[model samples]
Target: MGAEENIGGVAAILRPVAAVIVSVSPSGCVELRLPSRRRSWRCDGVGSAMWIALRQHDGRIGEASEMLAGIWRLDPVDVRCVMNSWAAELCDAGFLRLEK
Candidate 1:
């Protein structure tokens, strides 16, 4: 399936790869590094919340977004959009995977 199809809906399962290291700063910023690739991504604001929620929930996409939405008092629609966009990027970078 295409990458977007892979994460087509709320039912899609997402799991973080062991190779990527996700760090959350006290200020609620997020940083992710792929040690093997020697590359990193930094996320602030909403992105950081999404990152931390993913980590805390073992990369379950739907649950992570729900938790983050309630925590941040945001619309679920917005949360899902952020999750989908971030998931696409992380998947493209090989830091995350979609399980059928």
Candidate 2:
């Protein structure tokens, strides 16, 4: 299965690799870096919130999506889709790993 197929699900557990460096700005902007790959990604606003939520929720995708959905007044399913897509993209980029 593709990365998306493997990761874009609410049950998936997502975690950044050991070498990942995460920086959060006072404005809620999040920066993720993988020194080994010389790769970085910036997440602002809602994306930042999602990242924080995932971390706070211990990588539980369902919890993260539900938290975001409540904050944004959106459907939990829609938030899950977005979260899963984002996580899958990060996984494909080698920034994150999926745990069974």
Candidate 3:
């Protein structure tokens, strides 16, 4: 695996796991629920966009980011950074797992 796949790379496929549940509001906000931990997280605008894109694309991070960049009219570099950070956080939280 390349660095991207090894470390929360944009190329890495990320999915909601570990009993985590994702919900989207009618207004387009995204929320995450960790039932085991009894905790919840509300994603900001950028995160909402990423989450939706990831879900639509079968957890393909790089492809999701690219699609989000075009849809949101944001810089690709910024989107990648957010994706990397978000993926790392999810991995650490046990909400996301990488496919071997």
Cα lDDT of model 2 by residue, 63-84, tens digit: 8888889989999988889888
Model 3 weakest 10-residue run by lDDT: 1-10
Q: Which stretches of candidate 2 lie over 4 Å from their true place?
A: 1-11
Q: What is the clash count for each candidate, in the order shown?
A: 0, 0, 0
* Predicted candidate 1 versus true structure: per-residue lDDT over 1-100, tens digit per residue: 2323344463456777778887877887888889899988888787777777887887676678888889879997688777888888888888788776
Better of 1 and 2 by TM-score: 2
Please report the TM-score between candidate 2 and the true structure.
Answer: 0.84
In model 2, the worst 10-residue window by lDDT is 1-10
Which candidate wins on TM-score?
2
Colliding pairs, model 1: none
User: lDDT ranking from best to worst?
Assistant: 2, 3, 1
Considering TM-score, which of the candidate structures 2 and 3 is the better prediction for this target?
A: 2
Q: How close is candidate 3 to the true structure, as a TM-score?
A: 0.78
Model 2 accuracy (lDDT, Cα): 0.81
lDDT of 3 by residue, 19-96 (tens): 988888788799888888887878888778777888898987778878888887999777877887887777777677
Give candidate 2's error at residue 38 in angstroms. 0.6
